[model samples]
Target: MTTNYKTSFLLPHDYEIPTFNYPQYVLPPVPYNYQPYTQDIWSANVIQPLKTKITAPAQCKFDENKYLNLFSGEFNECYYDFEIDLKEIDPTIQSISKFQDAYKTIEISNLNNLQIKCATPYIENFINDRNVNLTYGNDNCEFDDGLLSNITLKKEGISQTDDINFENTITLYTNNIKVNDIETKYAIAYTNGLPSGDYSNDYITKTKSNVDFLLQVTKLSNNDNDKIKETYLQVYYTNDVKLKIRFSKVLVAKLIRMFGYLYWGNDKNIVIDINNSDTLGIKNNSDDPVKIKIKPR
Candidate 1:
């Protein structure tokens, strides 16, 4: 079955089909105030998906003559924030030369007892102690330049076999040294990168092959006299793993039905797992009964 197409499905619906491979990551938990370290030289850039506000067309029964009756309160309207999937992007890299004019500097607190990992290539004479004081980028060089000699550096060239690509990893580290009573910790990953000549921080191209879904709660339907009192969505996956569906925006929906298109096939049961969410509770929120659509893009 094709796995790169757009299709729509109704929630509270059921289907059975073969399962295919999808990307999975075991994310590490971070503190609320924690920020990731960042540099500009690495090719591993984070992609931010774009979002376009969409108003779903009315799907319930409405007056045919007035056309104004579409807004006559026959149906409840719900707005949802949606995102574009990264799978649709054409992957490419910005040339290394693009960052030649840029430099990233990070302050290392507790420098006396910490190790650091730097991503850029080393220039032998970038730092010299010939002058009493020196400066490079944002950091002031007060300690003797000889301190760099204590750093442990390693390099691994890119590997390819039979014209096929293999794992390519580059890393650097340093030994803890004290200078001017300042302590330095290692540089980790960061959320932003230096300005790109061809790319912007607003959007990102995929660096990995994993596919991600951008879903939105689009339309809510209430056709019965009894309102749906309490409603929440549960997403199920392989091995019965599930997650409660929540949107970034505040949305009011009942039996919500999301509508959108996908590039993949509609025959797969895993595609509709979001529809058959396990019941969160037996309690109903609204006395009115409606069907809400959960659309995935």
Candidate 2:
């Protein structure tokens, strides 16, 4: 069967063929709407597939559109809030330099005996001393200057990190040779060799292959009178494995570059397993036409 491509997915309503392998890397819609479905075709970024729903509705019918999880490189630089599938990204990365400029200060009470501990992979150590005793108004010390000495930090360096790609942490400890009152101001940042770009935060690239994992559109289809009440869509990606699917009726922003398209046979039985979903229904009007929009995220 010949699948004629338009922009994103091959024309769904009129097209029918055996399970065709349409590569999902988002690309300019091919002017020539046909590609061979070779057996060896496989996308590197694959979202896991789902089982068909049973018991009542043979296929999923919903009034709303949905979305899947795309690894976005946008978030806070201090903590990891989400997990970007490593498979979704090219992991063999080297730093042109690192990112993240940090500064902190800790007031040490009970200086008679004190122990503050921390660690970092960027340097053998961020502190010159790990164990010590002191008085309230006598000792003020900074540690980023002295190290096992392999890596060096600024005079105000407290910890070394690579926020350039992702957030890494540096730990500190207070150590020996102190007399009285110590005010430790850990004013630090990693900036000397940072790559030159507006992009100073962790991110993915346009070069890596991008693919849809799974696309699920849950709809509530009600007969015009006493049948089922129709619903609007809210799409979501299922990461059971990681390849993703885009949905109809809504557009989302993607973190990865766009390329090839995800084509399908006549089977749109793509329903996902979502819990606690807020269901919204539209009166399945027997008159007006309805349409769903699929977008990338």
Candidate 3:
């Protein structure tokens, strides 16, 4: 006869393990959204947003280089460096991106606006045919001023909030930008490990605007031609008038090195363009370097 006593098991049947929902952190070694582009920098047709940090020594905010951004003025910005694990996409892409350069994006708004720029590592040689909406997917968000702060990626598995090092997460630089009639607020993103594009704005700046753009370029730098006796060019601009330029049906971008002129038209057309440099050469001009200040007529 078998005793009908309940079999005592090593484990209790009534007690069950609690379920813990782990927050999925998109750390490295994750799938990457691969953006395809040409591999050449010269022939590539890409117009990436310019960097606040002038990379070209030959050109500055004051100077004119078709390869540089003359309209990019001084503003508060930051850079976020990240590494992507793209082995699944391409075996060659590791730690850094396939291309070493940082991909960049910029968004502009009035003082009421917070300009946001997003960047990914990419080759400048790309066709806008398949423009990468450098946006995030998996609960992923697009690049913006507050993006980094919202998404905090610390260590693998589960990481405590305190473990994150803010300093290492981002590098910040704040400058006092003089605001006048219209204060332009900007947010810039500079990141590698994804994809990038290029403005290649040299003597004349090239942008992604499909309409005629009018911007006033002001010379914030003194024509000192520093101790090195080397002349550097720098300038700034306003975005309010660009719309008018577009409506006028005159789509032309020009960087004038000549002299200034006065316009009599009611629609002043403050943004003016004149001559193109015959020589990219730096001239040993006046003892006081010439800094051209552009304003509305």
Candidate 4:
């Protein structure tokens, strides 16, 4: 019975586990084609084209034939009359109806052709060297007439956006004949941490007792008279903070006195010349140390 049970316990020989076949995974081929990048037209290229014609503004052309330099005076004879004819750069621009001071166009004196006509010789001498440029109107044109269709009239050194403060005194030594006179007493304040250069312009004017017109300050590293002429307010700082100013031309002083500060650039900083003055004096009113090379506006 045991042998029969063992024989019955044995499993069928044909019965076996099933097998599965998985498909092969093949990768795709790498790409071979390439493309180049391109850019569309820029706004500047579209708006402005190369080789485009530009209209130029009319300028004052120098006239050698009409140029005159006369010398006349009583005792101290100096170069008196300096006359020049400024024709338009465009020969076609003729019959100028009106002309005025280019920068300060408000001072219209019914003159356009000639620039300078000073009574005294020294004054003429001072003005002739400056070589002022003028703007004029055509026969049927107004004061605001233009030469080029696209360009606007530009007064080079004049600023329309500046806040100008006008007063009676004009300025201290620069304007007032009474105060600016050689006899008149001028004083400067010596304080720690005061403004210098263009910033000091207002500060120097306000801090001083008799300053009526605006005062400009410049820094001087060397004692050069030629360099001094290059600016209105020249400054040099030392261990002792004292103001050392040298004036040159009386004619220049008078011109500045009448016309106010002559701006060199658009900022309206006054332009000065040492050659315009005759008397050279040095004075020290304060003991403040010299602060050199402060930038001016």
Candidate 3 C-alpha error for residue 81, in Å? 2.6
Q: Which ten residues in a row are the worst by lDDT in model 3? A: 241-250
Badly placed stretches (over 4 Å) of model 1 are 1-72, 77-224, 228-230, 234-244, 247-297
Which candidate has the top score in TM-score?
A: 4
Candidate 2: tens digits of C-alpha lDDT, residues 56-171: 11221111122212222121111001111213322221211100011111121111111111111121111222122110111111112111122222222121111111112222
- Model 4 TM-score is 0.15
lDDT tens string, model 4, 1-297?
355443445476657768788899988998433221111111111111111111112223222342211111011211111111212212322322211111111111111111111112222222223222222222211232121111221111110011111111112221121211233323222111112222111111111211111111111123312221221221221222222222211111211111112211111112222222121111211132112221111
Report the C-alpha lDDT of model 3 over 1-297, residue by residue, as the tens digit: 877867766676678878899999986786544343211111122122321221111121222231212223222221111112223224443422232222121111111111122211111211112122211111222222121112222211110010111111111111222212122322212111111212112121111111111111111125311121111111111232110000000011221222111110111112221211111111112132211111111
Rate residue 159 of model 2 by lDDT. Answer: 17
Give the per-residue lDDT of model 1 (tens digit) for 62-97: 222312111122322111111222112112212212
The lDDT values for all models are 0.19, 0.19, 0.20, 0.19
Error of 2 at 281 (Å): 47
1 or 3, which is superior by TM-score?
Answer: 3
